[model samples]
Target chain A: MSATFSAQDPRALAEAPPMLSLRGVTKSFGAVEVLRDVDLDVRYGRVTALVGDNGAGKSTVIKAIAGIYTFDGGDYRFEGEPVNVTNPKQANAMGIEVVYQDLALCDNLDIVDNLFLGREITSNGLLDDETMEKRARETLASLSVRTVSSVRQKVASLSGGQRQTVAIARSVLWNSKLVILDEPTAALGVAQTEQVLKLVRQLADNGLAVILISHNMNDVLAVADDIAVLYLGRLATQIDAKSVSHAEIVQLITSGRLDVDSARATTTISTGERSGSESTDQGAI
Target chain B: MSTVTGRDLPGLADAPDKRATTALSDYLAKVRGGDVGALPAVLGLIVLALVFTGLRSDTFPTTFNFANLINQGAGVIVIAMGLVFVLLLGEIDLSAGFTAGTAGAVLGVAVTNHGMPWWIGVIVCLASGALIGLVIGLLVARLGIPSFVVTLALFLALQGVLLQIIGEGGQISISNPTLLAVMNSNLALWQGWVLYVLVVVGFGAVSYRRMAKRRAKGLHAERFSVWGFKFCTLVVLLGIVTFLLSRERSVNVEATSIMGVPMVVPVLILLLVGLTILLNRTAFGRHVYAVGGNAEAARRAGINVANIRLICFIICSTMAAVAGILIGSRDNGVTPNTGGNQTLLYAVGAAVIGGTSLFGGKGRPVDAIVGGLVVAIIANGMALLNQPAGVVYVVTGLVLLVAASVDALSRRRAAATGRF
Candidate 1:
């Protein structure tokens, strides 16, 4: 159900600039247009959950933000300044980090090495393992990650949740401003899912802009401050997570539109007509 | 995703003294989890030594035979060290043998035909080797061709080139005394002991410095006992080997007493130490492991994966070339088949048997030494027993198979235990 402040939310006040904003972002593969005129904003200190059904262009939108693919026609504004980010390296230079669904991590390397994979700490042309290990330890500690027994353990030894946390920590280790997580909780167990969700919330709470892409409604509702729904390569709606109900979000996902009156009427009819359905059902049978 | 606080984990608490216990348990757990490392190779070495010594009591462990074994194993060791880099990246160089052959031919032609100095011949050999490597690297890295195919093609083409350079039945004899002395000559007794002492002291100093530095930084350093154990092992091993090499091996009045460590042994040791540092302590080495472990992950981390692969290929070929030079010196000439036939296979076998994985991301330079020695010992011991060539081949093949099996099984075990 839409709330009273659904349309007049103070987030739209435009007093402070959004942390990152994309306007009319379009991406096409040959003749197939995957994203069309998409507009989204990731505000500071907030979690923006990007939710959509399969093949709904959610991945395309995040990839564009992650600079894995350049938008065909759009303006990418980071902190209200237009910037060109054609590659992940450039995106990282601008403090944009993406933790992909695969959690790209070297399984043979230790946690410290994985955290500082490309950008290693070196002294006198030799790897400074001490500094890297110390920093990795500090980063994990700051995130309150306790599942990992030791930072020197190979990634192959870590659990799925621990790997996800390492990936998350790695993204934010280099002063990232916008951290994007793709299906972070999809493969995790319940306890691990809860831990990851808590970490995601903590990321936003620490004044970082976190874009969480997930299919689980409960997880999104629990951690996300705002929900942006994508329907068939188009933005269906952007709404506050607190104002949306499960049924309403489901309806929006399936139909790409929200009919408040019809949704409410359908639920009421289903519940209220149960007692009267006995005689009508016998007659129909 | 469970929300257990750090305090909830008993052993994970911030206890300063628990670092040693955690490290020790972690190491034990790793071993139990199938990260047996060099243990298989070490045990294999001991068992082989015992068997061979029992069979040929007069020659197997004799000072002369041991010195000869080191000399023969040195070429394989150097070549296998290079293969370690390529293997670490989950790639192989099938052309290493022929590449070494070509290098030897080039050196032979330069020193004999062109009358160049021995050092110049060495430089020429290395450059040609590097050039060969560069071409292969470009083909593999830039063209995205499979390394197996690229190296196989090189293997065939290099053999042809080597044959053409040396001509039919044309073997160039090595005239430079210094070049031949690498494997033929032995160090003086005093000099041998001096080098041994320096190596032990150097290793001790470096280990102590690194441990101190790690401790000062409040990082996870090795336990003092572990360090001490390693130091003691090195001293004892080096002491025995050096003592054996320094003894005289005079079989008859006509034969001069050949005593002291072979010059090639020290050179091989130096190369091993250098490569160990490169692989374990440098950024490039770390990148190699990363690329081998997961190329996509390395690329996503902004690493130039292709570049790393290219450099590794170059290193492999160049080292193959060096091995060729050593072989030529040891043989006193460069034949057309210098590095051909079973040379490359033996080098690969040495690396794998020494504990370097064919699957990659799990090997060290020390593997070359250990594995190469095993290969050498088998060939030498079998020869001493007057065994047929076929038997030697069969035994070596079995060893390689067993090593590969060990690698595969341990990998599966590690996967099962959720560690590697």
Candidate 2:
């Protein structure tokens, strides 16, 4: 990365600048240091997967980025400009949106209402239902999400995958530059998972940076262009998805250590037994 | 970035309500699926009206009784309408009855003893109700006290305040002609017709424009024929009421002519329209539903849930103030028991009977009116049958129980079907 910018505004920097970059971020709860010196980079039009074991500070990293919990120490930068977002509203203003695991959707409301819960379109102090309904449908269509019948259907009647679609669609509804999805496909079925992963890919394809946090290795490897692994509140490695094997990721996740020789040896055995049909779109790469 | 799939899955059951026979069948499907809405209340109202008419044909079916029913039920209906807000948040205000009583007492003391004008007394009364609601809201929203406990405490405390306002065993006769005119007066025949015309035209225009807008967008909107039917029904219902009310209903037309629609009808109608619009077409209303449905989700969505709860409580109490004034107007005096005894229960009964779910996140101002009529018709019919107040209470309680059962049962059915 260059040290100097040609443009006056850091936000107007050249094409190579990261959409968001965090360096040496640390957080503590009382005497316990939950996260220590974590560095991560998210780029425009790419899906960066953040993977870690339970209690390895995956949520902490996300919370810090989402501005749910302020990091004790960090250089939190967005578009090369140092930022100190103290609340979720500020993060949203900086074009950062997080789709939590719970989706935070009201079951009693319809898809359109849920999508624009707090931010309703109004004219003359009255709800502009037609305008909101039109935009909601367009947003869904843009994501190629046709799993639900109508935008007016209540969320309570929607399937798990459809709910996830609505939740993801809600995040992208605003002009967000970065979206952090926590376990997007954690509770979906086989067919639904494929639909969601493609959606994740489509998000990046649409020029929005996406950070996907998941425990599923297949999902991580299948949808992520770059994988940033965290171990024990610290950065284990940030590597290209193509450069790492399944066993290598497993090793990094478990021990927070790298053994290139052993990883290369297990690749042959792992690839031989893995189903080729399951990886058709992935296999082309 | 990697293995991409979707937009090609044949497994999705994504069928829009775009199929043939969907208009009728879809309604049937929803009804079967436990979303019966206000049908039960309407049917209950119809059945009760018929039974009461059959029991006391000469007295019950008369136009005078019809007008009487409207006046008698207006107070409870308005109170119930206010309760709808608190009820929408899945909260209750048992103190609503006493809140009305307290407001009535305040109005009485202000106008009678203090020589305040009727409007000033009204403003003071409404303010007191709002203040009482604020206290309840603070305990429930800010302090996290359960609404039932806080309102229950207020219910007992407000009665003492009521007794103190009018004094123990003291009753203040409200001789302010303007205030008394609210329940005892009637609009002239021309005025009634004019009001009816305004209502029907206003309703038709709004509905037609909304439908036109939706249709213009190529979105799902009711068919013209369907809209026509609904519009025609409204016209017929209002026309019949106005036509009937315009006739002379006085027992002795020589001395007094008590014809035309009661003044209370127009007031109730105005309240109904305003509150309906407030609940359905406003951001604040949506937030109330959202918070009621899932407070955690609403909180995450950046909605101030506590504020919504606090406001709803205030609305409920303010409504209680209006109902109290109606009661005082009807009785021509303010008494300690103006909003005491079965007043709150009847209002709650009327709300539930109108199909406002006690479980929350469902109801309308119209529901209160419908439920109020049901309660009023029963009382009126039973009184014509020479039934004691005790018997009337028992019967109303039973009907309320039936309405509640329908609500709970329909919810279960809806859940089972919603899961499908």
Candidate 3:
């Protein structure tokens, strides 16, 4: 696996114009603050892995990114300009697609219908189902998901892995600029997991920035170029995968203890960058 | 002993390539309790006919008795057609009986007491019924009240209004000669039978052609053999009914001059066919089913569920009003008791027994007519047997329960097995 480095200054890296960037993102549910002053950068043609343990606020961060839950404070910038993602539709309109864990598909509907659901193509005020089905076939083929025989088949008839493939293909079909996949291989068989990981790598190689959230350390190591660990709603450390060992990442994720060398590595990479002076040690559980 | 394609073949008569055919045959075999409710209703009618024939011997099979069945079934058929639309949306209209009565009473006053034209009065009455239906629908949809509660209130309120409209006079007789002549007119024997045949043929052709077109487009098409069989059977069955009615004593009294079937039978038949198409083929119809099947899912799919529901209520109420005018015209007048309490029961019972699911998402106007005939046959048979009206109620209730139980069981099985 190849690792990515931001090169001595995270703020300077931001000045280089990321494909998408989040700055000063904070979220709270009622009285409980979940995400505290978090910042991240996603550049074109790179797979950025967001890894954390359970209750590390990874889901809340992704949900915030997906517009499932709004943030209390944040600056979301796309292509060097600030943008506001107030809802799923707004996020979609801005070319940011989130393929969540559930996929939110209607099983009774066929693949073409599910792919174009809520915004089906219409001609003369009636559904242009023929054109939609043709486009759906092309989209799946573009993703190299060849297991399906007919796009007209109902989703209920599909296997679990095929369903996931269809969902990923749906997001990509819309020309998304950034794709956030939540636990893409969480419930898959070994072979299916391999298929999804391959698809994820291919997605980044296709020039779109990818944000992969997974608890599987090995899978993340296999595909991610950069890894950001969050411990108890705070960013513990962000490091290049090639520079950090699996044991160091586990420690940083679970204990918030950046071993001497790994801490130096973070300082060396983000050297003159403004460090978020928040208490990462508060979540040292 | 029968092992041609396999070693110890177990009922595998055809090759593996014939699986689609086998599946279709299995579906057809389950038609009585299949996804379509029409099968069981048809079966119930046959069983009821046999039981009645057995009980009354010659009287039940007589031409006069059969004509009486048609006469009694016509009003109920019209009202039940209206109920099917309401029930298809998983809603209920309890005020149909009273709505019919109120509309009839108002029309009666306009035509008889105020000397207004019959046609104008009927239009006003239907509009009134439609307005009431809209109000009830709005209350149910907007206020989030249950449909049963909303309609029940309408039922009680309309009953009071109907009584007040009729006043202490108790009855209002129509003196409109043109209206009476047109509504009471029947076709001559041969002409009546011809009209029924033409209607059944016309309706069957339209249905089959549309279904075939849908099938060709890779959409669902009912089994061709089943569709053909149903259409042919209906034509023959209607022909027999017309023949029976033509042999009645009234025909001989008119010196065989009026050889056709009653005008109301064709009218009811046309209305049932029209409503069935309106509910099945339109986008609005699909939205209604979606709303009833799963409201949240329908909303997420961007359907205007509330608007669909409101339109359904208006259709149901307007249909009831139409039925009311027809019934009043047939009886030559309207009274405070024109649409009695039994009318509501008969209308709802017809819809339920005909295969309209009380749970919604499944129903047809044609099923309502079949259910209406079932109720009418029971009443006619009981009267012929000199049995009490109470017996008719018991039998009808038992049939309704059977139909509802069958529907519930079928739905549960469909959910479990994931068939159509």
Q: Score the docking of each candidate (DockQ).
A: 0.34, 0.27, 0.11
List model 2 lDDT by residue over B203-309, tens digit each: 99999999889777656787777777789999999999999988899999899989888988888988999999988899999998898778888998889999999
A1-285 in candidate 2: lDDT tens per residue? Answer: 111222234234313568888888899999998887778888777789999889889999988888889989978888899988788999999888999898798877889999999999999999999888777777777677867877878788888888999999999888888899999999999999998999898787777788999999999999898788788777776766877888788887887755547767533223223232122122121
Tens digit of lDDT per residue, candidate 3, span B321-378?
Answer: 8878877877888887777768988888888888788877677788888899888887
Ranking, DockQ, top scorer first = 1, 2, 3
Name the lDDT value of residue B383 in candidate 3: 80
lDDT of 1 at B242: 92
Chain A TM-scores, per candidate, are: 0.86, 0.87, 0.86
Instruction: Report per-prediction Cα RMSD to one decimal.
Output: 6.8, 6.6, 8.3
Best-performing candidate as measured by DockQ = 1
Ranking by lDDT: 2, 1, 3
The 10-residue segment with the lowest total lDDT in model 3 chain B: B1-10
Error of 3 at A185 (Å): 8.6
Q: For each predicted model, how many residue pairs clash, with residues at least 3 apart or on different chains? A: 4, 0, 7
